[model samples]
Target: MSIFKSRVNTNSDTYNKNHADSLAAIETLRSLEQRAVTTSNKRRPVFEKRGQIPPHERLSRLLDPGLPFLQLHSLANYLVEDDNPETSIPGANLICGIGFIKGVRCMIWVDDSGIRAGSMTKTTMPTIISLQEIARRQKLPLVHLVESAGADLTTFLVESWAGSGGMFKNLARLSAAGIPTMVVLHGPSTAGGAYMPGMSDYVIGVKENGLAALAGAALVKAATGEVADERQLGGTEMHSTTSGLVEYLAEDDTHGLEIARDIVGRLNWNTRAKPPKRRPFDPPLYDPDELIGVVPKDYKASFDTREVIARLVDGSDFEEFKPRYGAATVCVQTSVMGYPCAMIGNNGPIDPQGATKAAQFFQLCDSANLPIIFLHNTTGYMVGTEYEQAGMIKHGAKMIQAVSNIRVPKISLYISASYGAGNYGMCGYAYEPDFLFSWPNSTSQVMGGEQASKTMGQIITAAAERRGEPVDQELIMREEKRIYDYFTKQESAFYTSGRVLDHGVIDPRDSRNVIGFALETCLEGRNRDLQPNAFGVSRM
Candidate 1:
């Protein structure tokens, strides 16, 4: 009860006052948090700016309005050890969710660039893995918006050995499973970060702001003595055009997001299955005769196949994918009558084996769920030692495998020359289309009679010269012409008669209607066998 007792009482009184004030502050903070959450809920799905506009808002601008964002890791709460106080966020650096674009829902994962350059902390691996798992389980399209400086140095030891290696295995599995994965390059993306786009079926980028590369210019310079800027290093212009690294090059971030959304819309099963909501057309229809003028009458004269596609698809409804990737072949998604379909056509005068790109295009078609339309007019794959040196055998085989895998509805229209492996690749007898329509002007055969004639002529000349005899040039020419006629006219009749070719003849002006009827008929059959769902496996 002396000086010590008096001091203790004084300290206890002061402690009680401070504790009451702290409790009041806690209640006030709770109320403020509740208000914020309520306000956020009332507001449209807007992204919060941690250090920059959140990925959801960035995606919101890219997608159509009111499309719900199905978040994959909405409740992922984790922290890094000794994390930078100034830059740390509760979820570390990764952000993953599911969202819709024009009602096309897709699983999305974007890096939070504000948090340690969007580096992946140890805890971040599960978020990505979990998202991918959900996407695979639901057969949803997977979209990745990468903007990272690679793995966090502090967490690399724990995450790299235990986190990413197995996680990427799942990513590769999801891709191979045909989940329709797409990657968008909104900003610079490097290292393991770059692989995200590489693994996806389609890669998109902003022309100037987006950058994607296996290694940065600095790293490349370190590995190999070379000089190049960021654009040369990984810019969209370089990757989109020169390297074929990126499929679609957008003018800006907003455009890139839109392109991504458009791509998803085309590939998503939910979107593709619907018959396009456009006004119905007459039963028997065809492209305008003007399309004839659009394509050069001369086979040697190459014109943009896209123009032909534009003419055929609903007015301005054709959406091209991987435009820059396969220069020799064209792959696009468009609606004939509001129904999504994939079109794979040769770009120029065909090659001997057909376009090298044809095989790739065939592979894409085989993997997709929607009906496919083939605008057959390929010369064939390029030949000679050059093609052999290019490993045409392996690449062409890859395409053959893809074509064989197609189980969906397929319609092939031979608008011009459908020769050799090219014809086979374009749903010729080998691929067995549900319906085949040969334009009145179209010719179908194993290979171009003109091309085969040339090769046969050379062999005849060489053998005659080797035997020291005068070559019967006239006889040889006659024989070659005979070979051409047999295949061009006779082969068409034989195959059509045998039911091997499906439908034999169509009018050039009615090519669109021919395709429309074929697709419509096939889709009618499909509906009888299949019932579509809100969420289903998407196109590759």
Candidate 2:
């Protein structure tokens, strides 16, 4: 691995402008994630009065002190119908992330119950399913902080409800696959939602506050004319003493978290398997802050991908996989935070040769068991017959095939444009990267808005010519504007990320740390040992 020589002139006016733009984008990402918390915090008095711990606070307690918690999908469903997209404070009413619990890495899922009592929204189930999927693959223990209000009846969507069965199915599969799944009930989990604790390997419920029931008292009475209250019907006491649904009953939220920690410790998770040693070298030679200056907010603008790799890999050392061959697709073998991995980034369009280069690279990396980092910045597979005859489609498919079937962890970053087949080739969301993140300025769509509108304009003109009619330039202009506006609105990082397209929008400067954390998590999961059974832990 040779050191990447510096080329970015950070002192230039262009770089300075880029730096300013990047800062604003980062600020927006930070603000949106924080807005979700402040909105939930508005009900602090109500929760504290009821002897309940707020969701975020409970999460803090459960995680190891001072250790980083990679918050995922922070801005899930940020924009809503009829809300001003510009200022919409988005949250799925759930706080989900990966963090360490008692030195054991686990997926932490908390219901932001403070917001609408952490009601189940359309975004809720998918978010959890994504988290569960990550937990299953990463071999992470699932420790959920349950406190959701049941389904969001007000804005119910049949599709979400129909698809929700997969969530429980995944939970069952996690435990069956020898991954420990635990849930602590801090408050009410009613109706279908109660199944979360039922499927977990460990269940801890807060005494009076915890309630898991098929129906709350009002619903129960409405249907069966029963007079049982929540506490009497599904409190921790009853579950622990009589039904045996709850294995541990705690006095309060803090106490429940304590019990969860004790369970993790007792499981001897760390002792089950030896963690693979990693040679942690020094930080990148260049300042990560230079990343902002190096990457223009305009996704179309060209910038060397090595500028990013330099800021990310240890000691700015990039082992270029192929220096001159198929140069548009930059392939490199590198180490992020001492954990060895290979990175594939796009310099421009994925040409036929570049596509094959990347395909071969993915195969070699997978064989070496090194995690692959994808920095998405391609305009997609190159167009034009010169490349098509060169087998662009098939070659691009080979890259996608390799990315799709690779067994090693795939971590992706949407650095800029992630368009068309290039997205799939670079391991986009549908490819299911272990962690998918985006920079605030990143834009993703089938193609750029300008490009799509122009292509449509050309088609409209061609169709008009075929009919031997006068060119309707007005209509063409109208259609092009419409196409451009539609694509532009949806291509923003905020818009796609709000839909949970990627994990969340991240700051350019933190890419190294974030990627390193993901790599470490994947490594631990691959090595950790767990007890497997026919069904989820018997009692659960």
Candidate 3:
């Protein structure tokens, strides 16, 4: 019963500043998400005219009311197009999240046809792949509200054409792994996109709007001199009867969603096995609202990682692992909500001792079958002559090895700075964490802007001296400034989130709920049994 005592001074000037900065960051994230939703909502008129429900509305109808829907990559592809941020739309023309379908947890992807006719862009493909990956890993049933125009041919690239095959391959894998995939086709799904419904275990198509075809009328006419109508080639009627691609036909979008829900309900997904007994737990001793003040406004300013743990863990009761040795890397055994978990939080750079401690902690968590949550806020492993001599690389490699090989689920939350190997050690997205999220004030990069600029400046100055040439001080300053600005801008939470580096940026207040949901989702995967087959079920 080791309950942590709070050291956070909420009324302090520093705390107030930190809270204000965090609030501003959260507002920025909220505004961006609102812009994406507004972009979709603006198309309501068009969808109404077509007698089809808007993508978001369809999703709302599909999901169980009052249940939490964890949307992923809401601001994806923001400012990734041209340098003009004003014209750029976030969400990559797709709305995706995990939510309950008839009380059964499932992954849902909706084609935002309102934007670019629901076309797949360079930014959107990764989100699609990620959604599929989550479904496969979690064994969650997948439901898609399809109405995409497929890949945008105007900006088509060879790499995109080559990579498109993996989407269908994942569908096959999902079915083979005994995970159900249900698709509700509200509009066109042409070219390679037709395989979406083609590979699903259950497909519900709308009467007039649902169209799935290898080639549309225009393409058909261009390939051969034969003129054809789109509906005749691959309409819902054609697929439901002649082509046998559709399993169910509905009158409209609402009806299609109903059929999709009913299909998931009929899967008997929850009946496979009973979940483990729930544990009784106490809420955090500190207010979650205090989380905003825990993180400093200045990225370099130090804050106690335990302050964060105090507000997230049950009753602020954490059994610290190795309190004296390797104190920089803090490891604690605590429960998030009611679920037991091992958490690794960074108070500073990882020294040789810290790396070894983390590696050992990871193994212990793995052996106990408890999930690990990483609270990332480090510049990276310690450097300089002393650390190098102490086997920093060897110890760091051991930590990476432990993270890579651990069988239990890993969840990561970026609270502040995550730079260099610190990101890897803290389970950055590269390690394929079961779920990774970041606070809007967080930053991820190879190194800090000041450190990078200084290092580069020193290198340039040394190079000039070795070549018997005088270094231009102004030129060096300009180079350093450019490097600093670029890295600084790129490392911001918005930039990384737009690139789909993490799942999404979340408010500090929602940390507990988000982590709890992730734990429950991961636990379901651990408990559920899947019936695997040599090959997937194919359309006959």
- Candidate closest to the true structure, highest lDDT: 3
Indicate the TM-score of model 2: 0.97
Q: Write the per-residue lDDT of candidate 3 for residues 95-144, one digit (tens) a residue.
A: 99999998899999999998888898777888888889989888899899
Clashes of each: 16, 2, 0
For each candidate, what is the lDDT?
0.60, 0.89, 0.91
Comparing 2 and 3 on TM-score, the stronger one: 3
lDDT of 2 by residue, 374-460 (tens): 999998999998988999889988988999999999999999899998999999999999999999989999999999999999999
Which one wins by lDDT: 1 or 2? 2
- For candidate 2, the lDDT comes to 0.89
The window of 10 residues in a row where model 3 has the poorest summed lDDT is: 79-88
Would you estimate the TM-scores of all the predictions?
0.42, 0.97, 0.99
Please say which candidate is ahead in lDDT: 2 or 3: 3
Top of the candidates by TM-score: 3
Model 3 misplacement above 4 A: none
Q: Candidate 2: which stretches are off by over 4 Å?
A: 80-83
Candidate 1's TM-score: 0.42
- Which residue pairs clash in candidate 2? 78-90, 113-118
Q: Write the per-residue lDDT of candidate 1 for residues 92-208, one digit (tens) a residue.
A: 355555566656556678876655556666556656766676566545677788777787555468536556766667667776665677888877788777767767778897776
lDDT of 3 at 145: 93
